[model samples]
Target: MTFAFPVVPRYSEIDQQGVVFFGHYLTWCDEAFTAFQASVGYPYPEMIADGVDIQIVHASLDYGSSVHWGDLVELVVENEKVGTTSLTSRVSVRRRSRSDEGWSDAVTVQLVHVCVDASAFTKVPVPPRLVEGLAAARA
Candidate 1:
């Protein structure tokens, strides 16, 4: 199961060639992840307030097709691997047609986020609530 976020491509997200700039894909992936967390009642602000923080330890993306401004993209996210102190999320962005037939894959990305103590910035166990939330979302 995957968490999906709707993204409207902005003119600024495009390059001179009119397709989405490669770098923008990473930003959108992060945005989708954040949005998913928020949807599950664990937004970043709440995490930080609770003395937990997550930092991206790794990220990679593979582009399959070009996306241009005005295209509605759906960023789909799922847990790839969940470890004690780190979790890997797989994200995919696809072109969403206006009629809601669903999405067509355009790109895919994997990101690793390390859980840490906010004050010490030291690695910490993945919060129980977070783990449960992700599991439920996937289910």
Candidate 2:
């Protein structure tokens, strides 16, 4: 299953050329990921308090189209691949139609995060809670 987070681009996020800057796509991806985690009952603060931390080790974004200021975008996040110590999340951004209220693909961002022990800052097996949460979210 995929979780969709709706976000509107701020004027400052756009460049002088009138399109969103490439780097902001990653921020939108992170926003969707954070919301996805919170919806699944494993928000970042809670995860930290529980002694678990997930660190992004790799990230890539492919822009399929450009977006302007005030455009309504939906960041769709999915976690279909979970490893012993890492999770891969793909966030696809789509522009919402003003009339039809439909979405069109714009950007695709992939992130790889490794679960770690917060105190020791060492890699650890994916926490049971997180795994269960992701499973439940997927279901």
Q: Compare the candidates by TM-score and give the number of the best one.
A: 2
| Model 2: residue 25 alpha-carbon error in angstroms | 1.0
Clashes of 2: 0
> What TM-scores do the predictions have?
0.90, 0.93
Residue-wise C-alpha lDDT for candidate 2, range 1-139, written one tens digit per residue: 6689998998899999998999989888888898999988788899999898988999988878888786778898999688999999988899864664667889888899999999998999988888899999888
Report residue 74 deviation for candidate 1 (angstroms).
0.9
Best candidate according to lDDT: 2
Q: List the residue pairs that clash in candidate 2.
A: none
Q: Which ten residues in a row have the lowest lDDT in candidate 1?
A: 96-105
Q: Which tens-of-lDDT digit does each residue in 22-116 have in candidate 1?
A: 99998888889999888766788988988999999999888888887877888888887789999999998889656657668899899999999
